[model samples]
Each structure stands twice: as C-alpha cells, then as structure tokens.
Target chain A: MKKLLDDPAQAVTDSLRGFGLAHADQISVHTEPNFVTRAGGTPAGQVAVISGGGSGHEPLHAGFVGAGMLDAAVPGEVFTSPTPDQVLAAVQAADAGAGVLLIVKNYTGDVLNFETAAELAEAEGIEVASVLVNDDVAVEDSLYTAGRRGVAGTLVVEKVAGAAAARGASLAEVAALAERVVAGVRSMGVALTACTVPHVGRPSFDLADDEVEIGIGIHGEPGRQRVQAAGASDITRRLVDSVLDDIDLAAGARVLLFVNGMGGTPASELYVVYGVARQMLADQGVEVVRSLVGSYVTSLEMQGVSVTVAVLDDELLELWDAPVRTPALTW
Target chain B: MKKLLDDPAQAVTDSLRGFGLAHADQISVHTEPNFVTRAGGTPAGQVAVISGGGSGHEPLHAGFVGAGMLDAAVPGEVFTSPTPDQVLAAVQAADAGAGVLLIVKNYTGDVLNFETAAELAEAEGIEVASVLVNDDVAVEDSLYTAGRRGVAGTLVVEKVAGAAAARGASLAEVAALAERVVAGVRSMGVALTACTVPHVGRPSFDLADDEVEIGIGIHGEPGRQRVQAAGASDITRRLVDSVLDDIDLAAGARVLLFVNGMGGTPASELYVVYGVARQMLADQGVEVVRSLVGSYVTSLEMQGVSVTVAVLDDELLELWDAPVRTPALTW
Candidate 1:
C-alpha cells in the first residue's frame, strides 16, 4: 500500500511524536504508557473527561484533547484498541481530585479495556464513571462490536460531555450528560473506497468500482447493504432516511446535522452531501438548529461520508455552543 | 472515477449551495455572477480583502471568507479560473467606501481575469489594489502559470493580508503587506497520486505504483522530478530542503512552518511530515514560532502534502495571531 510512513509498526508512535510537537502549547504526550494529557494537567477539582480507541480515526480522541474537551486521550496502534494500562495511566494523569469520566465507544475491545482501566483507577481510591456510546444506527452487531458501532456520533458525545466537564460538573453529572447524548445521537455511513491498514499493506475489504457500501463502519466492517454506485442525491437520501426512520423525532424536533467526511472525500463533496441532507431533514419538518460539516472522525483515507443527527434540547444546545479549544477543533 | 458527485458539471454550483447553507451565519452566497460575501456585507470604511481562483482547492478562497479574513471570495469551475465578470461582481459587492484589495494567485488566467476585474471596478470609480502570489519554489514556469505556480503558501498571504485589512489598514497598506508576504514565503509539494477533475473523469497525470512526484504543483502539473517511492522521512526531507533552499534565511530566522495535506492524506501522515519538517528547520537554527497544520488548501482528494515556510516579522506575527472566525479556520 502507498502510505506516507516509516516502519509500519512505528506509525502510531511517530505520528504522535509529531502531534505532540506541533501542538505542544495545548497538550503533552506521555511515552511508555502512551497517553496525551492537557499541557498543564487537568484543572484542580474539575471533573476530567477522557476518551480513546484506535489511532486511525485521527482528530477524534487526540485532536479533541484541550481546554473544553478531553483532558487526556490514549491512542492505540492503527485500528487496534489501546491496552488497559494505557487507559489507566491516562485516568491517573488526568484525575485532579474531582474524579474522571470515561467515554467509551461500544466496540468490544474498547469497552473491555476501558472498563478494566476504570476498575484499576477505582482501586487506587479515585472516583471514576464510564459511559458507553453506541450511536451508529446501521447494524445491531458488527465484527468488532457487540451492539451498534460508535461512528461519527462519538464526536457529539465527546463535545457535549466535554463541555459539561469543563464547566466543573461532577463525574456523575458529566456521565449522565454523556449518556443523554448517546440516546439522542444516531449515525450512518457509506464507503466509496476501502482504507488500507498500514501494517497489513492492503485494503481492509474489496469494493468494486461500480459498487458502494451503505452503513459502513469506521473500521471497514460489513455494512447493512452493498448496491450499485449511484449519484450523490440518491446515496444521500438512503443514508438520511435510515437515520431519521430509526430516531423517534417529531415534526418540529430541533437537531444538529453533522456531515462528516471519511478521510479521503473533499470539502466540496461534503458540502454537497450536507446540502442534500439538510433539505431532506427540512422536508420532514425537523429544524436543523446547528450544523457541523468536515472530516473529523475518519477511516484512514477511506473515501466516504457519514451523516449524524443529534436531537438538541436547550441544555444540549448550550453545551454544544460552549467554547472549545483543541488542535483539531476550536472556536 | 469514484467521486461523491452528481452531474460533474454541477459540482461547483451544488457544492456552493451546500456551503452557503451550512455556513449561512457567516457568509452569503450570490449566483448569476457567482461569488460569496460576508453575511452582513463589508463594514463601511474598512478595506475589503478579496481572493478567488479555481474551485477544487477549497477552504482557500471560500472557507476563508468570514470575519478577520476575506470580505468576499469567488469560485470558478473545478481547476478553471474565475471569469472577469465574476471577479468584478465580487469586488463590487465587497467594497465599502474604503475601497478593496484583490489577492490573486500567480496563474495566467487568474491574473488576467482579476486584473480585468480591477479595471472594471476602477471604471466604476472604486479604488482597487492587486497582489500576485508566486510562492511555489518548484519550477520557474509551469503549464498554467508564467512564473512559479502559487501553492499552499497562498494561505499565509491571504491570512496576513486579511488580518491587516480587518484591522483597518488602507488599500495601499494591505496591498503592500500582501506583497511583502509574497516575497518572504516559499513552498514545495510532493504528490503520491493524481486527482481526477469531476468533468475530466480521468487522473490529471499517470504514475507507477512505486513512484512519487516531487516539487509538484496543486493542479498535478509536473514537478521537479519523479522518483521511486520513499519513506516519510526521506520524502519530507526533500520537500523541506527544497523550500528552505529557495528562501534566504539566516540561522536565527523565526518562521511559520505550515504542513498542508492534499485532500486524501490522513492527519496522522501530516503530523509525521510536520514533525520531520520542524526538526529539520530547528537543525538549521530556524525557530518555528508558529504552526498551521491540516488541509487548508487542497488539490481535490489528491494524496500528498506541501510544506510552507514564511518568515514572520513582529507585525506579520501579530497579524497571524489575530482572531479569525471562518468555517474552516477559527480562533
């Protein structure tokens, strides 16, 4: 596979080294255990928010670490879950005596590892709470996940919960807010091309040029269906319909519509998808109160897009609108 | 070619529709003589900063069209220059009583059209100044440009100039600052794969599986040479060396090192490149006081990157740090 990397085994470490250097003012990277923490450490007596998973979906856990977001982010090798020790270290480093909140995606490996880490942190006399995010509406079970996979909607969970934590909420309050977000958010994706894992040096799956996978997962897992390639509007309609049908939103429900690009898609195409999706929601009488369109959570240069809709209450909207300062996301 | 588009011809218009819808709070979209302007129009007596070019390199012209940046941006068809009429319309819409400044990339079509637009605005009794950006250090001449082709460094110019204009700099002062940026900045890129323009339906150039083009232009124009694929460090070293060599920098020079991803490359790869480039600069005694990473300027899903080094004086540094609130960039 053609990739800009050195030793395939060193991809994660090398990239993290660079990441720490480029964003030194915002975060500090810890080796050995491998976790990134806020530069000045978590504020005293503030509930620390932490998240992690595989490394490929960049700007996800790591990029979101800063003032109003993750206090620490632990990254595993590309497409592989971080070890329990890594997560425990992140928890220890981030806890500032107010406790910690862990946002774990529903993947089996991630859930187990983070749970183990939480247990380990609790044993050390530190308060800890864990919330599972399973927002993907595509499938009931996947190769790597037992429940619905956590795709782009993980971003919504992190953003809302991070805001709560940043405002000095307790661990229980932040955990409750995260669970509320998980209940309100839903996501679905389509892949035009598969991404290759650096170590494997081959595409994770094979997709014919004239076909597209609908409801695809971030790790190239099997999706709900595969169909002949179609135009943007038709493809977008399928995604929007599936997501809306699954969510129990009423006619006047207000929501945040996020159109996220899976690595390789350009901003122009993302905008096109956003316009089509926005109109589709409006036709259903759903008011799109806030919008996010960009490549935030991705699948290692995979050419695709994911549509996420999160029902926004007044409190949720306030949290979403709260100021956030991070490397990948800032306002 | 696999792309997220409908009728290839509608790519620009459709994408703009989505962009306008997604960012209605920040900017307004105008059709017929298509252009994008700040939502509330330019502030009276404030010098208007405007820029435009082909459509493919997104977030360059349009994404930078909010507060503290461009007052207006015009987009042409993919890889094609904006017509003189379109540029004229943008200038007219963005101009307040303080006149306007046009930032043009050093391309044959872009230069001619923007110049024509300036003359047209002058005929209408509006003061206008133009600055040409030719920062690419790849070749003295290229297929679409008479001299060096403008590449990623155009961002530095627009950002610095836009900040000046926002701070109420005169038309002449903004123009002069833009020119100074042009003189101090230099950039070079490497393309791992070619991109397919929507209407063209074919890769811009051909390359073997194990080949890479060094010193490449944004439009897939031939670069300095094609060599066997190498690891990230080797490739990044070549790019950093070429840019530093072209610009005359002393040992203690302070610069802004920008590592921009061509659309298809992932963030992981970009930081790898940034880390390498930053170290190389440090080894040469040049301090990277500021950094901007990610895909700001892109060549429609091309998998590659460009390194931009701009000498920053106290004034330029202050301007670079000025608040900018656009869709793609905000602080």
Candidate 2:
C-alpha cells in the first residue's frame, strides 16, 4: 500500500501525536489510554460533550475537540471501536461539575463499548448520559452495525449538541439536543473506490473500474446495490432520492444540505454534487436554508460522496450558526 | 476515468455554480469572462487583492474570496491558465476607488495572461500592481514554468497579501508584502500516484506499484526523482531537508510550517507528515510558531503531500492571525 505511514501498528498513536502537536493551543493528547481533551479542561458548571469511533475517518471526534465542540474525543485503532477503558478515561478527564454526555454512533461495537464506559463513569459518581446516532438511511444493518450506521450526520449531532453544552445546558438537555439532531438528520453515501486500511495493506473491497457502490457504509461494508458507473448527476440523484425518501418534509420545510467527500474526491466535485442535490431538494419545495460542503468526515482515502439532509428549525439553525472553533470545524 | 463529473467540459462551470451557491453570502460568481468577486464588492478605498490559475485546485483562488482575503479570483479550465479577458473582468469587478493587486503564480501562462490583464486594467484607468510567486524549490524550470513553479506557498502569499489589502494597505504595499512572502517561502511535493485530467481519460503519468515521484509538480510534471516508496518519516525528511537547504535560516528563526495534502491524501497521513517535519525543524533550532495543516492547495485528486515553510516577522504573524472567513478556511 502506498500510504504515508511509519509502522502500521503505530499509525493511530503517531497521527495523534502529530495532531496534538499541530493544534497544541487547542487540545492535549493523552496516551497510555488514548484520548484527547481540550487543552483547557472542561469548564465548571458546563456539561461536557464527547464522541469517538474508528481512526481512519478523521476530523470527526478528535478534530472537533475544542472550546465550542467536543470536550474530549476517544480514538480507537483504524476501523475498530475504542475500548471501554479509553472512553472511560475521556469521560473522567472531561467531566466538570455539570456532568457529561456521550454521543455514540449506532454501530454495535461502539454502542456496547460506550455503554460500558458510561457505566464505569457512573460507578465513579459522575453523572453521564448517552445518545446514540443512527442517521444513515443507506442500510438497516451492515458489517459492524446492527442498525442504521452513524455517518456524516454525526458531525451535525456533535456540533448542535456541543453548542448547547457550550451555552450552559444541563446534561439532560445536551443529550436530548443530540438525539433531536439524530432524529432530524439523514445521510447516504456512494463509493467509487475502496479505502485500504494500513494494517490490512489492501483495499477493503474490489470494485470494477466501471462500477460504483451505492449506499455504502463508512468502513467499506457492502452497500444497498452495486451498479454501473454513471454521470455525476445520475449518481448524485440516487443518494438524494434515498435520503429525501427517508425524511418526512413538507413543502416549506427548511434544511441544511451537506455534501461530504468520502475522502479522495476533490472539492470541485463535491460542489458539483452539492449543486445537484440542492436543486433536487428545491424541486420538492424544501428550502435549503443552511449548507455545508466539504470532507469533514471521510473513510481514509475512498473516492465518493455522501449527501446529508438535516431538517432544521430555528433552534437548530441558531445552534449550528453559533460560533465554534475546532481543528476540523470553525465558524 | 472514474471521476465525479458531468461532461468534462462543464466541470469548472458546474463546480463554480455550486461554490457560488454555497457561499452566496461571501462571494458572487460571474460568467462570460468568468471570475468570482466578494459578495459586498471590494471596500471603497481598500486596495483589491486578486489571484487565479488553472481550476482543478479548488479552495485556492476561488475559496479564499472573502472579507479578509481576495477581492476577486479568476479561474481557468482544468490545468490551463485563465484567459487575459477573464482576469481583466475580475480586475474590473473588484477594483475599488483605490487600486488592484494581482497575485500570479510563477507558471508561464499565468504570468503572461495576468500581465496582459494588468495592462488592460491600467488602460481602463484602474491602478494595477502584480506580484509573481515562485516558491517551489523542487526545480528551477519545468514544462509549464520558466522559473521555480509556485505550489502550496502561493497560499502563504495570497493569505498574507490579502490580509494586508483588507487592512487598507495600498496596492504597492500589498504587492510588496506578497513579494516578501514569495522570497521567504519554499515548498516541495511528492506524488504517490498521478492525477488524471477529466478530459484526458487516463492517468497523467504511470508508476510502478512500489514507486513514488519525489518533488512532483502540481500538474504531474517531472520532478527531481522517482524512487521506491518509503515510510512517511523518510519521505518527510527528504522534503524538509530540501526546503531547509534552499532557504537560509539560523537558529531561533520563527516560521510558519504548512503541511498541505495534495487532494487525495487523508488528514491523518498529513498530520503524520506534519509531525515529522515539525520535529526536523525543531532539531535544526527553527521554531514553528504558526501551523497550517490541510488541503488548502491541491492537485486534482493527486495522492500526495507538500511541505511549505515561510519565514515570518511580527507583521506577517499579525497578518496571518488576522480573521479570515471563507468557505475553505476561517479563523
């Protein structure tokens, strides 16, 4: 594999070391039991928000750790769930007097691990609440997930929930806000190429040159269908249709349309997909009031795109627009 | 070629439409002699700062058009320079009562076309000054350039110069600042795979499975060497050595170290490269006071990375820290 890595075994630790160094003013990295917490520990009397998953899909949990987003992020090995101890460490390090909220993606491993961590934290007399994110409309169950897998919409959940916490919401309020975002958001992805995990030293799947996978999961799990490669608009239509069909929106509903790159796709292509998806929503009389277009969440270097539609009310819009500063996201 | 594109011919236009739509609050796209201008137009007395080049590099010229950045940006066809007419249109649209400054990369076509546009703008009674950026240390001359090719360091020039213009510096002052940045900055890149132009229907260059092209140009041009693939640390060391060797920096020099991904690389890998590069600089007694790590400048889905080091004074540091709000970058 032609990846820029030192020992594949040391990939996560080394990358985290670099991440911490690059954003030293914003975050502090903890080894031994790997986790990252905001440089200035969580403030007193404010709910602490945290999230994590596999390592390859970067700028997700860890990159979002800062003043207005995640208070801490626990990172597992590439494409593997973080252990219970790792998550527990993050919780202990981040919790202030206001308590803590864990935003767990809906994968089976992630769910079980974060649950264990929450229990562990509670045993230590720390108040903890967990909200599961299952926003992907692509598949009901996949390789690592027993339900709709959390995908790009995880970013929306973290941002809105983090903003609520930053605004001094209680633990219950933050957890509820996260679940609200999970309910309002839906995402679907397509993969043009499979990504190679460094340790595996090969692509997760073999896709024919003229083929594309629709409704693919973030970890290269099988999608809903495999089909012939088509034009950008045709591919985009499939994703937009799946997401729009899953969400119940009225003619005047307002939303945030996010076009995310799977990884290797260029920004120009992401914008093209964004334009097509925006127009499709407009045709359905749904107004796209807020938009995000970039590769905030990705599967290593997979070349594809995911379209996320989040039904937004005034409250959600205000939270999204709230000032945020993180390595991966800021406003 | 597997790419997210409609007709290859419409790639630039379609993408620009989406960009303008996505950032309507920040920029306005103009066609028929296409260019992008600040949404509110350049301030009445602030010298207008503008930059442009071939289109595949998204978030470069176009993405940086905002309040604290470029007043306008001209984009050309993929891998081709913008026409003189296109540059002239941007100059006309962005010129405030003060003047306009064009930041041109050192590529021959960009230099010639921008020169013609400056002349045309001057003939129309608008003041114009041009700054040429040639920061790539990979080579002295190549297929598309007469001197060292400008690469990621172009970002350093545009950002610092744009900030100066935003602060109401005169055209001369902005141009001089841009030149100062060009003189202090140096960059070098390595590509693991060649990027295919959409219309080309094939990779720009072929490489064996275990080989890498060192010091490759953004356009897939020949570089300093092609060698067997190596670990991230070794590759980063080579790039750092070349950049540090080309520039004379004594102990205790303060610099901004930017590690930019060439589109297809992941953030994790970029950070891996960043960590190694930063450590090497520290070993040499050069302190990295400011850091930028991402795909701000890129080739079209080229799987590679570039390292840029720009010496900074207090003035440049202040300008770099100045608030910038754009689609691709914000602070």
Candidate 3:
C-alpha cells in the first residue's frame, strides 16, 4: 500500500512517539503504558477523564487529550483494543485527589479491557466510574461489537463530559453527564469506498464502481445495505432520517449537528452534507443550535461521511460551548 | 466517479449555499456578486481583508471569513478563478471607512481578476492594496501559474494579515505583513493518487499502484518529478530538504511548521510527518515555535500531504499567536 508509513507493525508506537513530541506543549507521552496525558496534569480536585480504543481512528482519544477534554488517552494498535494494563496505567497516571472516569466505546474488546481496568483501579482504592458510548445506529451487531458500535458521537460525549470535569464536577456527575450525552446522540455513516489497513495491505471490502455501503461501521464492517450511489442530498437524507427516526425531538428542539468525514472525504462535501441536513432539520422544525463539519473521528483513509445529531438542552449546550483546548479541536 | 455533490456544473454554488447556511452565525452570503462576507460587518475603522480564488479549497477563503480573518471571500467554479465582478463585489461589501486589502494566490486567473478588482475599487475611491502569494517550491512554472502556485502558505498569509487588520492596521501595513509572510514561507506537496472532479467523472490523472507524484500541485498538476513511492520519513525528508535548501535559516532561527493534508490524508500520518520534520529541523538547529497539522488548504479528496515552513520573526510570530476566530481556524 502507498501509505505514509515505515513499518506496519511499528506504526502505532512510532506514531505515538511523534504525536507526543509534536504536541509536547499540550501533552506528555508515556511510552511504557502507551498513553498521552495532559502536560500540566488535571486539577487536583477535578475528576480525571480518560478514553481509548484501536489506533486507526485518530484524533479521537489521543488528539482529544488536553486541558478541557480528556485527561489521558490510551491507544492500541490500528484495530486492536488496548490491554487492561495499559488502561490501568492511564487511570493511575491521571487520577488526582478526585476520582477517575473512563469513557469506553461500545465495542466488545474495548468494553472488556476497560471494565477490567476499572476493577483493578477500584481495588487500589481509587474511585472509578465508566460510561459506555454506543451511539452509532448503523448496525445492531458487528464483527467486533455486540449491540451498536460507538462512532463519532463519542466526540460529543468526551467534549460534554470533559467540560463537566473541567468545571470541577464529581466523578459520578461526569460519568452521568457522559451517559446522558450518549443517550441523546445518534450517528449513522455511509461509505463510498473501503479503507485499507496498513497491515492488511489491501482494502477491507470491494464494491462495484456505482455502488455504496449505507450505515457502514467505522471499522468497515457491513452496514444496513448496499445500493446504487446517489447524490449528497440523497445520502444525507438516508443518514439524517435514520437518526431522526431513532430520536424524538420536540417541534422547536435544538441540537449540535456534527457532519464528520470518514477520513478521506473533503470538507467541501461535509459542508454539502451539513447544508442538506440543515434544510431537512428545518423542514422537520428541529433547530441546529451548533454545528461542526470536518473530520473529527475518522477511519483511516475511508471515503465516506457520518452524521451525528445530539439533542441539546441548555446545560448540555452550555458545556459544549465551554472552551476546549485539544490538538484536534480547540476554541 | 463517486463524489458528494449534486450537478457537477452547479457544484460550486450549491456548496456555497450550504456553507452559508451552515455558518450563517458567522457569515452572510450574497448571490448576485457571489461572495461570502462577515455576518456582522467589519469594524468602522479597521482595515478590511478579503481573499478569494477557485472553489474546492474549502476553509480557505470562505471558511476563513470571521472576526479576525477575512472580511469577505469570493468564490468561482471548481478550479476556475472568480470573475472581476465577483471580486469587486466582495471589495465593496467589506470596505470599512479605513480601506481594503485583497490576498491573492499566484495562479494567473486569480492574480488578474484580483488586480482588476483592486483597480475597480480604487476607481470608486476606496483605498486598496493587494499581495500575491507564491510560496510553493515545487515547480517554478506550472500549467495554472506563471512562477509558483500559491498553496497552503496562503492560509498563513491570511491568518497573519488578518490578525494585523484586526488590530486596526492600515491597508498598506496589512499588505506588507502579508508580503513578508509569503517571502519567509515555502511549501511542497506529494500526491499518492488522483482526485475525480464531480463533472469530470474520472481521475484527474492516473498513477500506477506503487508510484506516487512528488511535488504535485494542489490541482493535481505535475510537480518537480515523479518517483516510486517512499516511506513517510524519506518523503518528508525530500520535501523538507527542498524547502530548507530554498531558504537560509540562522543558527538559532525559529519557524512555524504547518503539515497540511491534501483533503484525504489522515492526522495520524501527518503527525508522523511532523515527527520527522521536527527532528530534522532540530538537527539543523532550527527550533519550531508553532505547528499546525490538519487539512486547511486542500484539493477535493486528493490523497496527499503538503509541508510548509515559515521562518518567523518575532512580529510575525506574535501576529500568528494573536487570537483568530474563523470558521476553519481558531486560536
């Protein structure tokens, strides 16, 4: 594959090493545990927030680590879950006098390892709470997930929860906020093309030139169905309708609409999707309070787009507006 | 060819309509002249900064319209320069009591149209100045450019110049700062594969499975040379070496390193490039004071990366660090 990599096996570690130095002003890298923590450390009395998953979805867990977002991010290999020991190290390093909160995505491997780490942290007399993010409405079952896979909505969760923690909320309060955000958020993705993992050295799947996969998972897992490729508005309608059907919004409800590119998609297209989504939402009388259009959480070089809508209340909106200073996102 | 667009001919206007609606909070769109201006007009006495070019480079001219960036942005069709009338409209709309400044890239069409707009604005008794950015070190002359095609460095120019204008600098001061930024900045890009325009319905160019286009232009035009694919470090080294060779740095010089993805590359890979770039700069005793890694200026869905190095003096560095509140960039 013509990827900008050295060795497939050493990609993760080498990337992290580079990541740490590139963002050294904002974070510190711990190679032994393979985690990134805020450079200045979390406040003494503020709850520490941590998250992680496979490595390929960049700027997710690691790029979100900073003063207002994540306290620490533990990274695994491209599509592999981080070991429990790695998660434990992140928890121990991030925990101050306040308790720790683990934001785990709803994947089987990630769930097991994070849960085990939570138990280990508790055994060490450190209070820990976990929130599982399962906001992707794309599929109910996948090769690596049980119910639904966590997708871009995890970004919304981390932002809101991290804001709560930054505001000196308790561990229970932060975890509760994360779960509340997850409950109100729904995401669905459509892939125009498959992605090639460096190690795999080939595309994850193949499709006819005129075909596309609707509601595809972030890992390139099968979606609801394949169909003839359509225009931006049509594809956006499918994703937006699926989300609107899954969630109930009052006539004048507000939401933070996030139109995310699946790695290789351009911002021009994302804005097109956002434009179509905004018109659709207006037709349905759902107001878009705030919107983000770009690649926040992405698969590696997958050509597609994912739309996540989080129904927002005043409190949630306030938290989202709070200043966040991360490498991937900053305000 | 799969693309998230409606009619290929109407793609530019449609995307702009969507963009205006999505960012209505920050900017307003005018169709007659075809430009996006600040929703809240510029301050009465502040120098009004404006920039524009062909569309498809999202977050460039349009997305950069905000409080601390451009006062207006004019757009043309995909890879086609905006008409003189369009540029004149933006100049008229954004001109405060003080004056107006236009930032034009080095492409021939962009330069001619913007220069004509300046003459028109001056005829109307509005003070105006223009700066032409030609920072790409890839090729001296190309299909669309006379000398070098302005690429990602235009973002730096707009940002620094925007900050200066926001500080109430005169049009002359703002234009001078922009010229200084262009003088110190150098950039080069490499493309792994070609992009397919919606209307074209085919790849812009073809590449064998194992080959890559080195020093490729943002429009997929030819670069310095083509070679077999290389590793990230080796590719980065070639780019960095070319830039270093073109510019001379003092023993303890500082620079701003911007590693931009050409729409389709991932952050993980960019960070890997940044790592190698930082080490190489350190080896040369050039310290990096600031760094930005993401897709800022881009070709639509082109799978590539571009490296830009701007040798910064204290004044330029301060202007860069100054707060910016654009849709695509914020400090």
lDDT of each: 0.93, 0.93, 0.90
Stretches of candidate 2 exceeding 4 Å from the true structure: none
DockQ of each: 0.84, 0.86, 0.75
> Which DockQ value does candidate 3 get?
0.75
Q: Give me the overall lDDT of model 3.
A: 0.90
Q: lDDT by residue for model 2 over A1-331, one digit each (tens)?
A: 9999999999999999999999999999999999999998898888999999999999888999998899999999999999999999999999997889999888999999999999999999999999998989999888998989999999999999889999998899888888888989999999999999999999999999999999999999999999999989999999999998998999999999999998899999999999999899999999999999999889999999999999889999999999999999989
lDDT of 3 by residue, A130-159 (tens): 999999897897989999999999999999
| lDDT per residue as tens, model 3, B162-216 | 8999988888889899999998999999999888777778998999888888899
Clashing pairs in 2: none
- The residue-by-residue lDDT of candidate 1 on A1-331, one tens digit each, is 7788988899999999999999999999999978999999999999999999999999898999998889999999899899999999999999999999999888999999999999999999999999898989899999999989988999999999889988988889999999999999999999999999999999999999899999999999999999998989999999999999899999999999999999999999999999999999999999999999999999999999999999999999999999999999998
For candidate 2 chain A, which ten residues in a row score worst on lDDT? A174-183
Query: TM-score: which is higher, 2 or 3?
Result: 2
lDDT string for model 1 (B37-106, tens) is 9999998899999999999998788999999988999999998999999999999999998999899889
Error of 2 at A164 (Å): 0.3
What TM-score against the true chain A does chain A of each candidate get?
0.99, 0.99, 0.99
Give the C-alpha miss distance for residue A326 in model 1, angstroms: 0.3
In candidate 1, stretches whose alpha carbon ends up further than 4 angstroms from where it belongs are none
Question: Across residues B136-217, which tens digit of lDDT does each residue of candidate 2 receive?
Answer: 9999989999989999999988899889988888888888889889889999999998898997889999988999999999
True contacts kept of each: 0.71, 0.71, 0.69
Give the root-mean-square deviation of each candidate in angstroms: 0.7, 0.7, 1.1
